[model samples]
Target chain A: MTAGTEMSGPRGTLPREVPSASQDSVPLLEAKGLNVWFGRHRRQALRDVSFRLAPGQRLGLIGQSGSGKSVTALAVMGLLPDTARTTGSIRFEGRELLGAPERALAALRGRDIAMVFQEPMTALDPTMRVGRQAAEAVRLHASATSRATRRRVIEAFAEVELPDPERVADAFPHELSGGQRQRVLLATALLNRPRLILCDEPTTALDVTVQAHVLDLLDRSLAASGAACLFISHDLAVVARVCQDIMVVFDGAIVETGPVARLLANPSHPYTRGLIAAARLDEAAPGSRLPTVEDFLRGTGS
Target chain B: MTAVFTVDHVSQVFQPRRSALAVVALDDVSLTVGKAERWGIVGESGSGKTTLLRLLAGLERPTSGAIAFEGAELTPAGRDSQRGFQDRGLRSRVQLVFQDPRSSLDPRMTVGAIVAEPLRGRRRRAGASSLSRPDRAARTAEVLAAVGLSADAARRYPHELSGGQRQRVAIARALAPNPDILLADEPVSALDVSVRAQILNLLTDLVAQMGLTLVLVSHDLGVVRHLCDRVAVLQHGRIVETGPTEQIYARPRQPYTQELLAAVPRLPAVLPPSDERKPPRPLQK
Candidate 1:
């Protein structure tokens, strides 16, 4: 299929370039036949998952809870637990990351590939001031003076559109609201202008209005930095709003993959169809039973 | 229609122990829930939607104004009392289903005991005139079945069940008392997408079958639009908009409501025709 143009939202600005799926341009991050199992019982978490993320491309991995979405992100970050066993290949910037040394992976983590987690409160330190916490990223990635680091932190804070940047910088994690904390996380993620960003349900805990603002900021930031993004979320609408392409995962496997508009208009997989049907509550008739996953899966003879 | 609940200018304020200023959680909120009417309280975090629901559930009395149930004023519970409802009858008539069944369900107790606990409370109050042990067991099984759980499910603990099954247990416990009003707080926010649909369908079916009044609190407008006829949008402890769901969705009067509705992410409006889609296969059962 031909590369689709970037879908625009009310406040969204188009990216610098659309990453063509068929083009032979070198991908920023590529996963091939990735599989993960946990514990002594060998419980499978991910099953032959694979995808390519081109530079400046925003791909959404949409799935329900425990569908191996977060596991995929964690595997890329080299943050999975010790009990788990992983096979297959993960390449970032032409370097194989599957069995790479921890020291090498650590060096690349915050500087080249940053992650923004779902729960900002727990992700941040309660005792550290917000500005100081953000400065840590700059302190580790770059050799800069304390004064310069402080200025950069404030600048990052302002970039994420946090109100009263200096005041927010001084406040602890508890002082800020959920949305504010998430902004702090975003600022930290973008501190080094990473080549790729792995966001796992970053806006799930936020209110709709706050979520929209954060998403808008993320879109603008990614466009400005020209960074590839693997945005993971369970909400289809949220994914469609931010991503150029979407991969629908169910039970640790990709059920369907395509451009957001084409997938939504004509979903081929039963699971994807059920998910779209369930989320499109506006189209559902009031007082009628909503279609569930089982309803769609029953006749498919999977 | 007779009003099941009349919340009259209720305001809840909390004064921090160290702070001189008082935090106003609910600012003179007034609304009426008519009999069998499904009302949704929509809001973002820190918008006081939960505070309003708690006030209606008789869990907390407002610092000012009064709340009436069936035209009778709700008074605070006396000292050493567990519940805030002064009238024991009101306590038995209203039930609450909380978000995150993981925290809501008592993990130590069997599902049967948890569902039957309400019946025992009523029996203790009614002094031997309420349901006997056998009848209570029968009622527990009946409610479990109503929620799509089997009679054998009563023997298992909450940990033994999936997220969806645990929520069903919570629903069974709420319905066992046969309450006239059901208040659910973000019922499906914690569940997976598929499980959320099943629970939503179950709630719709149960509410219709029982003719129960529902007060659903959610941050998702789509869920609210699907389950409720009327909606009350709350922001920072005040009701900004209150009207029919269709009117609120189509033409929001308040700027805040409009912003809230517009912020909700929606799918592209180019779905294929329903008939063009493959027909669902027959149910294996």
Candidate 2:
């Protein structure tokens, strides 16, 4: 065992409070040999990346932009633009998704899988009431009466802990603050009762206090529903706070993956170490100089 | 006596409509910025740090209070401060360096023209009817060198230079008028972490060398701890905690202040023979 990494128990679903978590068995969702490219120039957005989304696994996908984190999620959901070309084997409980028809993919989305994006304004309709939008997502996946739909919407809103569902439902996108809008976006994603969620920088646009609240709401919902999530963020501190396991993505490839405690404690890959080192510098030590990019490069080199 | 400016009892309330709720941006916020004070205002979004800086700059009027620059009221008593604000002498006394330098600087204008803008204004303010073309070029070159930029940057657009270089040009423009104080709102927050230190150091050096008073609006407490002697922790339009930076960090009174301090990342200890690491809070499963 690596030094000081003995507390890292086997990759299994242990009790809560362990902080150390990983998957020893098969995952709920698995992607194998994924590839994505855009434009006639064949710009590769993702390059042969693979990871699993196991039940109760709060996995963080950390990387800078163009590092292939977002593109991988988009490809899984069949939401990539027509300009993009893809080749990958995505399996959800032994089912292949790469070649799955558009209709099948649509059925899977919101019902089996849902995504919360960075900007809620883009995910939500500006003109439509937030409640109706959420209701429509629920109705699209499950057959329900108007009253039942209203109940589900209220439940979803309550799940995300929105203060007042009725007022928020009646309110337009502009009426809610940045934090409220993000909660509504999460509520919309949950309306379909998806088993797994793809959170792509959902809290990046929010304030720190509000981001804490949003993250708490997510963890609470995940705990209750047994829904695993792939949480992506550029900040490793936030990732350490939220994720059980982390997959360090860089240059369109996942260079390292391990339990959160193990990865943060001793990152093996150079890129992973660079991220951890960069994140560690944020510690407010007095009188000491913060590490520069050159230091980060040197650490990565080592 | 090296203090360049002081903001005292500043309070601003926006009353857009008769029935609309009045928003108090700052309340009795007072601070004395020393010659080399790299003061930072930190808080969550809507914490009124930006509003306080504006009041200091005479950009907006405090519903009640005063801003004194070397004992001269920024909001002059008899005439509109707006009149003095436009006066090249008063305007150049305190300058603002905005957050997004790319947008703050005119894209069409080259670096030389942007830096030279204030110099020409100063000349015109001094009743210089005209200047020889050679003289204008010489003045621009002098200011550019002082800001540590090469003459070649004179020809490049704001987009041509990196973020740090663009900020340097902005600093050069502000320095052109030779302001005694510079107010920067969340400067370098948009830049990558690596670039942030360079900008912070530049502001520190500028203050020490040029004797500039810097009132920085930022959410970074670590930067504030290193730069400022004292800090006022604002919460919900109120100054919850104000004290020496060392004291505030050592013994945070307000829970919000404590929370903000706690949030600043701690360098993860590369654990020695021991295994377990203690975090501030345990992860809730």
Candidate 3:
């Protein structure tokens, strides 16, 4: 086994009686011992994962596809399919969410906690106008009057810096550009001023210039609302920019977790090191072999 | 000493079915690619880089302007039509490797059949190496070997191979005809990060060994920096800047080019050894 890697047990240590958790000021979201299995064969997708997000804190979940990063997000949101089995504790504002009744979870979903997905096109209803979509979040979570909801929706659009807020609200999702659509999704997520937000690769589908703008918008909104964020993505530079702390997940486990600056500077785990190496597009000498995850896995005896 | 491919004042306009506005995909774009020179076309989405590449490949005709391959004008005529051109072989000398291999490579076909597709098209023309059945098999095996794939891979279906291996098959198929110019469109974008390096190294090695001209189109400036000798930045269907790779990276002239460079994420550098390193998180009590 490679040095610095512990394979036979839980990959990460949960905070014991977190000084900053519940009593001191509850973490916006906390997950512990999250295990998920799917299908008849009972293939384990995630294994014993644990993490905590303080209020207004930004935590980046970094991993490749099929690494259980998305599954973690799903599990937290109670959006996992019926066939899949899940166990472990997920707390939102010190409230138990795992195995909560669908009625109970649905009530908290858009009002207290919200999500932004990778592809806004599929997430938004093609038939509905963008304004109605934002207003719906407010309607579902709060008892605002119709006029107030309309005003809130327009305000949300302006907050995201969408040009011509009223026109954007009136337009359908397909009518807007990729960046504009993503802004609408942000508007929906922020409509209720939720305490926490779960973003799953929200900028992956966008172009570089547009991605930069979206990242800026997300940063500004998070600051303005002071909401905790679980930002998940495959890009290291993006995570570095938006998150203060980082957790490297692999094969459904948290292989490494630490402050973003600390982990980036000196990654202890081989997987994290491999990820850092792979993301270094500028460092590789011309025509040189790029160090891959396979190289690191080979060291791990996998 | 002559240029391998030249695109002069190329303009492509797509007339929308319902809308009165005609979308200009490329606007008066001109570029010259020299023999054995590796060129990178950097642009965001809808920047007409792909359209310019399609023009060079003869896949689409420019609405205006002209493209010349090896000093001969490329016509809208299909590859089979001579159309007053002396070099009837110009069409076969240029090959394109697409972005998505799963879609590009016919899934129903075996890897061997897919790699030999280009050579089979050339078999009709009489030459010293007319590619007998055995010659085709030998060429397929040789190209596969050059791409770091085993001869056994020839028998397997596209579904049997991993994404990286499928891309290798695509590259092999592109090389089967022994084309002098190779165009790759975001070859590594769909691939996993680990496998991307291997494919890039393979491309670099192949281009050097075969002395083939390379045109790579990607949104990633880092990949461009590593593979291309020269780069052309595209914005709003126009070439805003074109220069050597080192100069472009060190000192970008255009605002768009500067934005692209700024967007490329940098790997966090290994920190200097110091006492500031905190101890690992303790296991829960």
- Candidate 3 chain B, poorest ten consecutive residues by summed lDDT: B276-285
Q: Is candidate 2 or candidate 3 better by DockQ?
A: 3
Best by DockQ: 3
Report DockQ per prediction, comma-separated. Answer: 0.35, 0.19, 0.35
Across A168-214, the per-residue lDDT of candidate 1 in tens digits comes to 99999999999999999999999999989999999987878899999
The numbered model that scores best in TM-score is 1
C-alpha lDDT of residue B112 in model 3 = 99
Q: Candidate 3, residue B56: CA error in Å?
A: 1.3
Candidate 2: Cα lDDT at B199? 64
- Backbone-clash count (model 2): 1
Model 3, span A33-114: residue lDDT tens = 9899999999999999999887777889998777899999999889999878998899886777887778777777887789
Error of 3 at B77 (Å): 8.5
Q: What would the per-residue lDDT of candidate 1 be over residues B2-66, giving only the tens digit for each residue? A: 58899999899999999999999999899999999999999888899999899888787788888
Task: For each candidate in the order shown, give its overall lDDT on alpha carbons.
Answer: 0.86, 0.74, 0.83
Task: Tell me chain A's TM-score in each of the predictions.
Answer: 0.90, 0.87, 0.90
Which of the two, 1 or 2, has more lDDT? 1
Residue-level lDDT of model 2, residues B1-285, one tens digit each, is 735667777787888685577887887777777776666677877889889888777787778877776676778657687776666466666788887787899999999889878766533444434445677678778777876689888999998888778888888888776677788887765554445655665666677778766787766676677666678888866788887888887899999988887765443465322234222122333
Candidate 3 per-residue lDDT over residues B1-285, each given as its tens digit: 678788889899999899999989999999999988999999997898888888877777888888888787786434432433324565557789988898999989999999988787643322435578999999999999999999999999998988899999999999988888899988887765656776887898899989989999988888888889999999989999999998998899999999999877565566423233221221121
Listed in order, each prediction's TM-score against the native is 0.89, 0.80, 0.86
